[model samples]
Target: MKLYSQTFKDHKIVFIFFLFFLICQGFFSTKIQYERASWSNVPKAPARTAYVLSFLGDEALAHRVLSNLLQNFGGSGGRFVAISDYDMDTVSEWLFLGNSLDPKSEYLPFLAAYFFGASQDKEKLRPIIAYLEEVGVSGGKEKWRWLVQAVILARFELEDTDLALRLANKLASLWRPGMPAMMMQMPAFVQLGMGEKEASYQIMTELLREEGDKMHPNEVNFMVDYICTRLLTPTQKESDPLCIDVP
Candidate 1:
């Protein structure tokens, strides 16, 4: 009887230890995952909805929330350190999801594109440009201007001139009366980048004439002079009006 009682006590103690170990293991696992999610900077839905993400799936509201979150993530101090490569990737993923929720909204894509451009991550910027290009195509004629601006940044800042020119050509074809002149001028700029100086000059000359036809001839002269002075070198050779290199 004594031996049986001792064996039973040992078994109960072992069972208690096993239960304690399981509890500790679970607690640590939950804590680690929570920390990971926190550092990831992805806003999580509440548990009452069974974490279904139904609440966050609202398009406009989700965009607003994402804007606020991005602002918070972009702030100074401790947050700056948290915005590492991994964190940036995670934030971009969140932005992508937010855009998916509100694909038609100009706010989210533009806002996220600005952030991604500042990131200087070529991989990240590609997707942003792609998304905005789709927006430019399907949304409205007005949105093409935004797409042009994004593409210009890709060309000058990111040095992705091929995509930039392609987008610039796309936007130029859709140009409207009220749209910005830069939309029409971007293809010329891309041509300059591609070492086609004469082609760019001719395009710019044509663009100046088009602007002059719009009843603002003097205003258009300043634009042409600005483009030639800043982007091209003046030469005594009138035959080659705008040379890529100084004569």
Candidate 2:
């Protein structure tokens, strides 16, 4: 009982002292979270701004506002690029800005496009591919950028037979070592988009053979449904002769 009493007293004294410290800090520190940016009180920078603002940004206009901040904090050559490198995880957006500001930046737009699905707008992808073809890829890491762009374009269902075949060949060569299992499923989609039914089936069956695991009931059910959904869309009969790909 005596030991317990001493422990309680010690904890109580610590808690009281900590509360007093917090009260002192509160009186001296600026309440930055409630303060907004203005002429007299412009924020130093978004990342350097208080924690609350950074946390608030992801949902509340973060992507766009960050773009604006990067633009305002000096151009791509200076602190803006530094801020982007230090603060942002998705380097693509700032890369887009960088590449646009300096045409020589080969990787930024491609990286951004990959992260933000920048090529989803088919019209935008045309210019991106044109830029790539003109300036060309940079580093060893950059080869993957074009390969990824090609694959992304294929997924958009924009590329026809020749492009699909070319991309498949490139992916085969470049991606053989680190072949992400999920991507093997893509050839089926690409082949089907090209109206090659038998080829699509063969590729998809290969994917199933390699990746399918039914040890868990949930996994089995999910694979079954995912495969079935792709294979049996209402517009195409299961026995349709024109297709062989994942729907």
Candidate 3:
């Protein structure tokens, strides 16, 4: 009976120790997980040649892998990381590296404008916007749409009308013969938003003279209405040829 009692006591102690160990392990694991969930760090991108070499000299494969990694960088471990927690300058560097690897890919630009650009920290958007502009300009007509997005991020997201107008002007400079009228008229729109109605009027007038046939009828009518009803005085509207019947 004594021997049986001792064995039972020993087994009970062993079971208690095992339970205690599991509790401690769970506590520490939860602590570690909480800490990880609370903070995130953005790592700098590797050099271009080193990155390509790491992927067995396949630049295309490198770009694809890097893009995927970037998309999920701060959101791993089943934890949510706030966009504001990221160091956007470092993020911009990674984006630039990705672009260098594949300028033809729209992946990075899309991520830059829509994903990272959505952050509430508007100032951080500067570098990302600049990256978009660089890619948009260098990538030519096919990529010019990114410039439009950048202009939007600057105008509405960043609330920097001047920057928006500057990007709009840059977009205008890239305009070709068959391009959309909205692309060429982006500056005037930005100008109107900035309350530069006269400047906007002058731009629309030039567009009417230069590209009227190419512009859609709705676009032309909207411009004419804006000029006659909103911009010109009653006396000016009476004499202006475009405003003659625009009442």
User: After superposition, which runs of candidate 3 have C-alpha atoms over 4 Å from their true positions?
Assistant: 1-40, 194-247
Query: Which digits, one per residue and each the tens of the lDDT, describe model 1 over residues 1-247?
Result: 3556667665787899999999999998987763422344444423323222655545567566766666566453444532334344455556556655566555555554445545545555665566567666655535564575466456755677788889889877777776567677778778675654444444456555544465244434543553566445544233344333323
In the range 145-219, model 3's lDDT, one tens digit per residue, is 678768877876687899998999999999888766777888877877654445546655765675567545765
Q: After superposition, how far is residue 71 of candidate 1 from its true place, in Å?
A: 3.5
Evaluated with TM-score, which candidate comes out highest? 3
Candidate 2: segments with Cα more than 4 A from true spot: 1-111, 114-121, 130-139, 142-146, 157-161, 176-189, 194-247
lDDT of 2 by residue, 123-173 (tens): 344434433323333334333334444554444424545665555555555
Can you give the TM-score per candidate against the true fold?
Answer: 0.50, 0.30, 0.65
In model 2, the worst 10-residue window by lDDT is: 78-87
Error in Å for residue 210 of model 3: 20
Error of 1 at 56 (Å): 7.8
Query: lDDT of each structure?
Result: 0.57, 0.43, 0.79
